[model samples]
Structure formats: structure tokens, C-alpha cells
Target: MALMTTDTRYTKVAIALHWAIAALILCNLALGFFMEGFEQPLRGFVIQTHISSGITVLLLSIVRIVWRLTHRPPPFAPGTRGWEKGLAHLVHFLLYVAMVLMPLSGWALISANPPPPPPGQIEAAPAPVPGGAAPAAAAPKARRGGPTKLWWVIPWPKIGPIQRMGTTPQGIAEQKLLHDTLVERHMQIAWIIIALLVLHVGGALKHQFVDGQAEFARMGIGRGRRAPR
Candidate 1:
């Protein structure tokens, strides 16, 4: 419905995307770290499911950004001084950039990977990656965060590259190294993004509960117009 702020507040869509993405990203971060612990993992099963989920999230995020560009959001409360406003904008900008980049990097990293089916792991006929993924039960809303959370996955554009490698270990090492580097970059950016999100969300909550302001509402419901005093 209404997307613009009439009285300096967030619209419903913006609020929903903000919180939903935040939760998703946070979960992804936790999972990415957890995945690292699994020394060797299997595919065509649980891992496949997980990767598929990631790709879905990534597509939605891209959609969210396009939505953001088309729609104008509500503003911070009047009491939001210069520094607070600046910080909020900065945090949001960084978040958006990281969100997009995280997945793209993963996709590229996946692309760079040299595909040699792992030892003892048998290769199955390649699945068609509509957008660089398997033709699956459901599209990947998979977030790549467990290890990378570029969470920008519908599982993502990784498997196709592997398919191209065609079980050749010839170029696999270089691809693996490239993939590792992309993964590392994804992790580093994620930490920064997480910290910023924490600060942003924490500050918003503080303003809402402690400072007794309607900052959160600005992003939750469409901004309400006020009567002249």
C-alpha cells in the first residue's frame, strides 16, 4: 500500500524486509561458522538442501533492493540528531552492499571452483542450474552464511562451474584456492556487516524502549502524519 513516510517512519515492507533479512543473516552467520567444523560433508542430500535454501535468500535480497530503489522509506524521528541519522544511513548502506556482494562473491567463488568429484564421492548426472543451481524441488532460498552467509543463495551459481569442470582435477586446485579466497572475503565482510547490524538494531531498540521514542515504528508501519500543535 503506502510506501512513503508521511510522518518520518518506515513503511511495512521496509520494516518487514529489514527484520526478516536481519534474522536470516544472523542465522546464516552462525551456520557458516558451524559448517566449517564439518571436515568432510556429503551432497545430494542434507548439504544440497542447505545450499538450495541459500540461493533463495539471495534472490529475495536482490528483489528487496530493487523494491527499495523504487520505494522511498520513512525518515528517522525528529529527535534523531545528526550523528544518529548519519549512523543509521551508513549502517543501512553498508548492509545493503554487503548483502548483495556476499552472494555474488559466493557465486563467483563457486564458478571459480574446479570440479573434481571428491574422493570416494561418486558423481551424478549434472542438475540444470537455472541461474547456476540444480533444477531442484524448490528454488534455493538457501543462505550461504553457515560458512559465508552471503546468504545470498538459492543455493547459488556454484554447482554449474563444478559441472563445467567435468571431473577434471587438472584445474581443480586453482579453482579450489579461488573458492577459498572468496569464502574468506565473504566471512570478513560478514563480520563487519554483523557488527553494524547489531549496533543498528541495538540502537533502534534502545530508542524505542529506553529513550521512549517511536524510531522502530518509523520502519515498521507507514509513517503517520501529526496534527499541528
Candidate 2:
């Protein structure tokens, strides 16, 4: 195979998207684990941020995948070990798959749960008029049935009919089961992604320092080139 030249580097757009997605994923993972520690309003706020960030990841991942399909990345440098190259390819593929699935599972889980009631202003009861009776209390507005909004701003579409299932007693039990199942799956996949990241980062460090390959530059960050591995 022809060795990719040292001059080859990812486009600036690809590099920007790559780092941005990485940052978002790390933040989302942290938020997922810690959001429950907060009280209601703050917890709600963090959850909103987490969901928004996850949606952003999904959107960026799609664009990244399209860009990658259309523009080939530079090949492994000269004398790269077969095992290292193979492992790198496998990790990269899995990361892409996780990026797509993580947010989707999250959205599904959110849809399974009911949307919170909108914040309402408190009103004083009207004073009794000179003669007769008190006014009837106003009925609450119906909850909008759909996917949870991103950051409580952009509306996201629901995945399954899970929201509807929550209405009945029997359905509530089923919804709880489904919601828990999806949460387990999402957390499991998250750990897989984290494990893959450790391997990926370790490999880069090995290539950069131990092998003196400057391999990290392929993603457009580190200095390019060194003695051949």
C-alpha cells in the first residue's frame, strides 16, 4: 500500500467537527452520570443541556459521516503495523456507530417519559363580589404529546408510542420497564464508547512518543512527522 505523505492532514472543517463532537460527548457522559445529584430545577436544567448536547452530537455525526464518505482521510504512515492499523479502523467505526445510536436511544427514553408541565404563574383568587358566588377554577392546559424539546427550545420528534403508553395504569408499568431497558442500553453503549476512546487515545500516545511517529497530526492537532515508526 502507498504510504500517505506527512503533508496530508484532515481538512480544517473535519478537525473542528471532530473536536467539537468529542467535547460534547464527554460533557454529555458526565451530565448523564451526575445530573441526578442536583435538585429539581437545576437537575432539569442540566438534563436539558445534556439532551441538547446529545442531539447536537447526532447532527454533527451525520455531517461528519457524509464528509468522511466523500473525502478520504490520509492513510496510515509508512511502516505502520498491520495490527495497529486494523485496531484503529475498528475503533473508528465503532465510535461512529455509537455517535449515531446514543442520542437516538436518549430521545426514545425521553419520549417514554411524560413532558413536565409548563411553568405557570401563580394568581390570587378573585375577591367575592357583593352578592353571590366564587368563580370556577380554570382547567390546566393539556400536555403536548411528543418528543422532548432540545434545551426546551427545539422540538424533537418522539421515537416510539411510549408517551401514549404512560397514560394507563398497565401502560405505565410497561413504560417504566421500557424506559429502564433503554437507559441500561444507553449506559452500556456509553461505557463501550469510553473503552474504545481509551484504546484510541493510548494508541495515539504510543505512536506519538514511543514510536516517534507524530501520528496525532493526522487529525490536525499535533506537529507532523518524525523518525519513521
Candidate 3:
């Protein structure tokens, strides 16, 4: 039997990381869904924000994993079934995998096909010649992959191998194929994360409301009830 104590709650750092990552993931999901509807500079800004948020989630997830490995989580509320515990563990594991993979896949996607210049970087077409004929428009610059700024501030490098795929015909074709595959995979992983999140939240609610367990409290919501002895 386990002794009842407040010590059963997760560590403060774990709780902070959990909420931070959750918030970022939700925001990024929204951005991904609606980014296309935006026009021009706004669209570019939204996409960059999405990437920055994803990278932030990835970094925080790594920290959270390390914290989890070192610190023991509170035991399940008394009377919790073995199957419930197993399912919870499985969902958590998948969430972690999805969290890591989603950002990495996004990085790879961008690397394979570098994004166009942001609105600020694009040069305006020269005014038409005052007298007779319009000046010929300058040719658009070819996109050579480069570092992205996190939140338009910190520099985040592209995946070298993926970004360095040459400009040759063959290399371009391979890069395009890889980009398409990664785009599909990224969406697939997102759906998986959504499913896992549903399960996780539903399970917690079931335990807290139906079973009268201090589920949220264990994750630092409210005061935790004593663990069953």
C-alpha cells in the first residue's frame, strides 16, 4: 500500500514544462490549419511563428523528458485499474514521440524546400520609366536555403543534409519528393497527437470526476487529496 502525502504531485519544473508545451502545441495547430488563408506578408509571418513555436516546444520537451527521467511521478490514485494505468502510459509515450517528431519533420520539410523570402526581404519592382517603355522587371532570386530566425530573432539553422541538396535537376527532383513525403508525414503525426491528447484529457477527467481522484491536483492544478494507503 502507498502512504498518502502531498509529495505525490509532480515537481514544479515538470508542471511548468507540461503546460508550456501544451499551450504551444495548441497554438501551432491553429496556425497550421489557417495559415493558408492569410495573404502575403501576414501569411509569411504566421508560418515563421509556427516554426518558432514548434522549435520551442521541441526544446522544452527535451527538458521535460530529462526531468521526468530523474524525478518520480506520483502514484496513481487508489483503485485505479491496471488497464487504465497501461493506457495512460501508452498515451504519454506516444505524445512524447509525436512532440519530438512533429518539429523535426517540420524542419526537414522546410529544409527540403526552402521557404520564399519574407515580405520585408522582397525587393519592390522599380517604378515604370517616366517617358516611354516600362523597365524590365528584375528576375526573381533563386532560393538557396538559409538559417531561419526563431520568432524573427534567434537564428535556427536548417538541417544541413536536407538543405544542401544541390540545385541540379536530379537533386531538385529528389528534394521535391522528400519534401512532399515529409509534408504528408507531418500532418499524419499531427492527427496522431490530437488523438492522443483526447485520450489523455478524457482519462484524466474520468479519474478526477467519476472516480473522485485528485487527478489535476497531482499535476499541480489544485490541492491534491491524500493518496490511498
- Considering every candidate listed, which one attains the maximal lDDT? 3
- Residue by residue across 46-140, what tens digits does model 3's lDDT show? 98899999999999999889878877787887899999999999999999999899999998887885344456775333234335243334322
Q: Order the candidates by TM-score, highest first.
A: 3, 2, 1
Model 3 Cα shift for residue 75 (angstroms): 0.7
Q: TM-score for every candidate vs. truth?
A: 0.67, 0.78, 0.82
State the lDDT at 36 in candidate 2.
Answer: 76
lDDT tens digits, residue span 1-229, model 2: 2232224566667788899999999999999999879998898689879989999999999999988887778777787899989999999999999999999898778777543334683422223333433322321122224446877888877755777665554544455566778999999989998999999899989988888785778777766754243
| Of candidates 3 and 1, the better by TM-score | 3
For residues 4-52, what per-residue lDDT tens digits would candidate 1 score against the true structure?
5455555557667766766666766666666655544432233344444
Q: Which pairs of residues collide in candidate 3?
A: none
Candidate 2 lDDT: 0.75
**Alpha-carbon RMSD of each model:** 9.6, 10.8, 9.2
TM for candidate 2 is 0.78
Which segments of model 2 are wrong by more than 4 Å? Answer: 1-7, 114-147, 167-169, 225-229
- Candidate 1 or 2, higher TM-score? 2
Of 1 and 2, the candidate ranking higher by lDDT: 2
